[model samples]
Target: MHLPSRPDLTKSVFGPQSDFIAVVFSPVLAEWDEGAFCMPLLDLLVARGYQVHVYDSLSLAQESSTLHATSENWDAYLRANYPQIDLAVGQAYGGALVNSLLSGFLKTCPRVLGLSAPTRCSAELQSNLASILTCLDMQGETAALDLLEYYVKPERNDKYQPLPPTKVEESGIGQRLRIGFSQLMKADARSHVNNYAGHMLQIYGAASRLVNTDSIVVSSDNRRQISSGISGCGMRPVIEAPEIALRLISDFLD
Candidate 1:
């Protein structure tokens, strides 16, 4: 089914000197901006002539907001909000949504880059996510984030370092995190990944047990769809080492 042609994106998303349009589907965190990937990547993209827009669902998901979470509905959301997508970048949870949209509705998009996207949530991921949710229920927001960092960030040989929570906000943040995490664990975009016709580059950490890419086979027939893993970078290569991620992205998009 062809989506009806729509008007240009809102003026707020336009850049005066930009040559291309790009949108980032941000991950599931209230403090997503604090992550190393946020600014560094955006700056790099802007340097490459991309007018970038970041759509962080959690940021707008107040009790009264209408933004949905699951992969099934994001294509409709994008069609309604931002119809002209030149480049689509999804980070983690956002990646799953991007994959889904690309294969089914937004396949005409030129290129997509997935940073540690959870396109295939394994049993291990589900368990870890459930534990994090439980921690949120019992220990509170900061503790839950602490648990999340432990699970998501690991060094070479899959070793984890103790990192403090980036934000210390009211308990209301917990509800948003809970909703996002639930959707993260449930996201599976393998079918979308297989069917996507656009150019794709999906990167993950070498030792990430959270997102199993074993079953995600990007066929050589579609030379555009490629998947790579960064050794010693853990699950979040974008955060652990933004330079490496940036270089890889630049190389791919160029």
Candidate 2:
């Protein structure tokens, strides 16, 4: 099965005329070819009249470490790019990035949505992730992918095929992976979520082994949570079942 060529992250934009803007961040390990993982949600947001911006977080981190360093930098970057953002949506590690900025960066208190995002990272989780990176570095891409699959246990979806394999040595991908995981390990979304004074929607898959769903909670007046019991619907509920994910997100955004 041939997969679509990954879209260039820097050139992709959908829903040009909508007043509302949404920025999506891709998962850590999938950053090299983010479009494969993020396109489903991006297309859905565009169809729903939202001007969406999809970013390759690993790439951005490589370009500038300060982008995620503080709330000030995050606020400046968003305000400079878009006149306003109605909502912010993130997946997995990307969700952690969004969560880190919500409390201090977004002044307008836009609604926040997180899909299979972890609120905290334990020492064990960090060590396990580090081991995956080591596998990628010492062994090869195949070994890394295998270890990651075992750890994340992502659901298999026919609609979305796996991204084409790439070498860790290509385009300094190994370094970027290291940086991304480091950021993820340090991310603590609980304080940010607790401090955020806006509506929130969190969705998780019942079979997700990557993120602890119980640690995620919404304190806003308007809060919704969904736990899909679909078989093999792991951390990537969006990719495993885009239709259901879109419907739930669209309904919540409306």
Candidate 3:
């Protein structure tokens, strides 16, 4: 097996001695990418002179010969290395990981904030997921492969084709892991958002509500979601993140 290699994470970003530190976690699909919705916030923190670190949960999960990179592993890493990290930000599946980490890490900080994070797992989607997982033959090791054929990969006569491009680049967190992980997350707390449904729900919810707050950048695409159906719902005013990111970081460090 090709053992995963750790990215030179510390070398890529600036970590200042400021009072607060913001650690951004990536989606469960694994491997943290630079294009994450919250990257701009990290840039903003860097500009303000607070220390910033973007934890590559994907990288850690794959590269750490010792760790599996699930939500729990990510949480443990935070407790060990950043027992003091204050503010955290994540998107989609990333939001779930960050939220879980906060439940534990917040003991070190005063308060925690979630951007488009799901508070509970969805209980109504079980039958639908069960049907889907059954069609994918989720009982064996090839379960992930089964799901890809049914969901992630374009259905065709041949099963060997290039996979679809994900919102985030990098592939250590394979389609099997992504989809299988998502399916298992249907009702499980640790798995749901960090799994799939919650991630999409949070992002969808955030897309609809990004106009009211000043914590994040409201992209034109997000603006469109505000007017059109996002993931499924209509748009509304929500928190913008730039200022929130800065303030959260300041508080975390102090």
What C-alpha lDDT values do all the predictions have? 0.68, 0.64, 0.40
Can you tell me which runs of candidate 2 are displaced by over 4 Å? 1-11, 62-72, 154-171, 220-231
Q: How well does model 3 score by local distance difference test? A: 0.40
Better of 1 and 3 by lDDT: 1
TM-score of each: 0.79, 0.78, 0.48
Model 1 ranges with Cα > 4 A deviation = 1-19, 32-36, 59-69, 81-83, 155-170, 212-221
For model 1, residues 100-213, the per-residue Cα lDDT tens digits are 676644787888888877666677878888988877777678778777877777633544443354444556668777777776666666676777777888888876756546
What digit string (tens of lDDT, one per residue) describes model 2 on residues 1-254?
A: 11123243243456787777787766776434645676777887888888877666553454335335633445556655566678777777777777777765453556777887666665656776788777776766666766777667653442323333555454555566667776776667666677677767777676655665453555544344333333456777778777787787778878
- Order of candidate numbers by lDDT, starting with the best: 1, 2, 3
Task: Point out where model 3 deviates above 4 Å.
Answer: 1-12, 29-31, 60-69, 123-180, 183-254
Query: What order do you get sorting by TM-score, best first?
Result: 1, 2, 3
- Where does candidate 1 have its weakest 10-residue lDDT segment? 3-12
Scored by lDDT, model 2 comes in at 0.64
Give residue 178's error in model 2 in angstroms. 0.4
Worst 10 residues of 3 by lDDT: 228-237
Whole-structure CA lDDT of model 1: 0.68
